[model samples]
Structure formats: C-alpha cells, structure tokens
Target: MIPHIHRRTFGTGSRPVLAIHCSLAHSGAWRGVGAALSDIATLHAYDLPNHGKSGDWDGQGVMHDTATDMALAVLDEIGPVDVIGHSFGATVALRLAIEHPMRICSTILFEPVYFAPLMADDPGFAGGYRHDTAAYDQALEAGDTAAAAKAFNSTWGDTAAWDTLPEASRTYMAERIHFVRDSAPFLMNDSADLLAPGRFAQATGPVLLMRGETSPWAEDLNGAIARRLPNVQEVSLPDLGHMAPITHPDRVATHVRSFWAAQGQGLRSARL
Candidate 1:
C-alpha cells in the first residue's frame, strides 16, 4: 500500500493535468507550466516521497513504487487526469500510463531518463554513462555529499552549475544527497524490465516527448522511448538542455501548452 502523498492544485479548470517533477525537485517546479495551461487545464502537482514537502517513503526507493504512490494520490484526490512529468518523474508517469492506462487521457514527458534504450543500442554509450556517473557514485562512497551532488548535477545539467549555487542551496542539496544517491542506483540499474520488449505497448494515450537539443545523451535515450510508445510525438527544443524545465520554464511551457491544446480537442469532444 502507498502512503498518502502531498499535492498542490493550480488553476480552477475542471479538466485536470497531473504534473510530476524530476528528482530533487517538487510540485512547485511545475508552476510555470501549470500557469501556461491554466486557461484549459487544472494542474495537480505532487511532491514525490523525499523530494519536496512530502514525507519520506517507508519502503524501497524504486521507480515502480514511486509510480504507485503517485497513482494512489491520483485515486484519492484527483481521479483520472491528463499527466505530465519531467525526467525521473516522466519515467514514473510512463509506468503509470502502462499500468493504469484508463486513468490518463494524454501524457507529456520532458526527457524521461530511463536509459534502457541507449544501453541496449550502444554498449559504448552505456559504459560512458556509467563512467561519467562514477564521479557522483564515488563521492557518495567517500562520504563527500556536496561533491556527489555537484558531480551528478554537472553531468546532467551544467558543469559550472555547482560552484555557482548559493551557499544555502548547496547546503540543502548536500543534505539530500543521501536520497539522491540511494535512488540513482535503482533508476540506472533497473533497466532490464523497463526495456523489456513491448513494455510500453499496452499504454494507450497520446504522448508528447520533448527533449532539449543541447542535452548530451538525450538524442538516443529519447529516440529509443519514442520508437516504443504507440502514439508518441517527439519535439526537440533548440538551445535548451536537460534543465530546460527549470531554467527555461516559460519557453518550455509554451511548447507544452501547444501540445496539450491540440490533445485537448479530443478530450473536449468526449466530455460534451
């Protein structure tokens, strides 16, 4: 059984859109996107366990369990919803759509980081990802929390990003390094099942998969995901990286709203 998770609802529209943020982020991160779609969507964002205001999870910190927790929250508070998730959150959303297809009318994901597809297609790429991530993993092993956070963020985000962080932000991230460290292994290693043939075949929904053009490894990773989903439309944003949702929320919101608006037509007609 999943524990009760904390959620924040934005807008007053009757049509609901459940937003799940990436690792180390929270519901507040979805504010910009929520605001962008306020005219047509009631955004329901949740803080996954150990991320934001939500309490720490009691059991394992795996993606499937996290997805279940989010699903439970939807059942209790919002019922079925149009879903949007970013990075790790996107991975969870994909699982939920497959496991509970009836609950999601449409889905939008920003660089879901499952990595299984890349690994399967290119051994060298998989090895490089592990090597790059070793810096963060090693720091965790050596009990250098700040270094771990910096290394992990630098690889997926910006190289100088860590040093530029304000002291308070640095301290907070350092404090949460343990959660990041523990969760990283499950996300990176649990690819066998996630990449299983036809894993996404059962998920029936219109999916929008967006990735930043500057993202280092996303081309292959996101491409792999797009090929699997039955009805998926992939969009690439120029001059943006993996952190676009956080760094360039307004621009990202524009693209997202456009995609949602198009999908909303079928939903609106169904409602009437």
Candidate 2:
C-alpha cells in the first residue's frame, strides 16, 4: 500500500529541489533552510510515514525502501531536481542519486548516517559508536522508548538539553524513536547495497557532502563516501553538529550556495 505522503513547499525560485529532513523530523523541518535558499531553489519537502501528518508505516516492507519510494513519488511529480537531505534523509537522497541519476541534477548530503563504511574502514569508530549508543539500545530493549529517545537525541541532536525541549517535542521524539532502531539494517548494515562496487559511480553529477566539525563520526563517514564518488566536494562546518541545518540554517545555506556557485550555477532573484 502506498503511504499518503504530506508535502510542503518553500521558497520561490526557478530551480526545483527536493529537501528530505532527518529522522524524527517532519517536512516542516526544512523551513529554515528553505527560506535561506529561497533565491536559488524551491524546496519540496515531504513527511515520511509516521511523521507529521503522514500515515503510519504498515510494516509490510523495508522501512528505508518505503521511505525512498515515497521520496521518489515526489521526484516523479517534480521532474529533474537537485536533492538535499540531512542524516537518514541524506541516505535516501544518496540512494536516489545512485539509482535515478537522470532524475537528479545534483545532491547535497548533510551528515548522512550511513555507518556501513565505518564498519569496513574504521571498525574502531564503528565500535565506539555502538558503545556510545549502548544506553539507547538497552532502553529500546527494555521497552523504555522515552529513555531511548532521550539517549538518541543527546548524542545526535543539537546542543539543546533534553529537559529544555518542550514536552510535546519530547513526546513526538519518543513516539518515533523506534525508527532509529528500525533503520539499523540500512544505516548500519547497508541493506540497500548502496556501496556496491560501481554504485557510487552511477551518480555522475556534482555531489556536495557536508558535515559538522563537531559531529564525532561525520568526517570519517563522509570521507568514506567521498572517496567512492567521482565528482565530490567535502566540507566540514565549524562549530556545527549533526543538526546544523536546523540549528544553524543560514550557515548551512551559505555552504550550499557556495557549492552551487562552484558548479557554475549562480544565484538568481526569487521568482515573483
């Protein structure tokens, strides 16, 4: 069954861009970045299943595949577009660029949580990541979803304190925390086979891989992905973390603009 995806558009620009938010976040999460890029791109973001107003995942197939299909539906409607994604969404964006290169002109990936590279190239970092998230894993095992959510957020979320977040935000994260676990097969194990020999070469267009300097695992992971791509530029944002796109949208947008400019796509005035 096709999940009913809820989409939101931002910006008034000639370029069509699909924005995919991180896990546990809805399409609204792109508002800040979208506004920042209003002059150059129109962002079409969608709520993944079980997020925002979208219907729940029916558990019939791989959740990552389902999410990718939902994003593909949006791509089909919009025609060729540049893609931007954060965290888990970045993984989906990468998949789209690899599998549907003709439909994607470029891709900007922010802190994609594809850990398979770490396991292969830097087992120590992968082991450390597992150790760091052991508490979250234990909480999930114990059926303490709230605790798991807190643990997960503390590690990957912006510098905000869990207790400082609104009660509603906490509840929202807790309700969707299982997605973190459910995504393990793809993120940790690379169930999608995205790293298969010659797969990264499929994306022939320019690829911008950005990550926060403060993110413990981002540099190594992005490095692994960058090494595989043919035309790739890697940037590390100073003082930013995994959620830089949300907490520091303007800074992130600056890099996005620079990347496009480097590719000879200059910014244009927003469409009326």
Q: Which candidate has the top score in lDDT?
A: 2
| Tens-digit lDDT string for candidate 2 (1-272) | 76999999999988899999998889999999999999988999999888998888888768898899999999879988889999999999998989998788889999898888768787687778879889999999999999999999989986689999999999999999998878888898888888788888998888999999999678888988888889899899988899999999999999998988887652222211
Output the worst ten-in-a-row residue range by lDDT, candidate 1.
183-192
Q: All candidates: CA RMSD in angstroms?
A: 2.4, 3.0
Error of 1 at 126 (Å): 2.0
List lDDT for all candidates, in order: 0.76, 0.89
lDDT of 1 by residue, 195-237 (tens): 6666688777888899999887888889988888899989999
**C-alpha-based local distance difference test score of model 1:** 0.76
* Model 1, runs deviating above 4 Å: 61-63, 184-186, 267-272
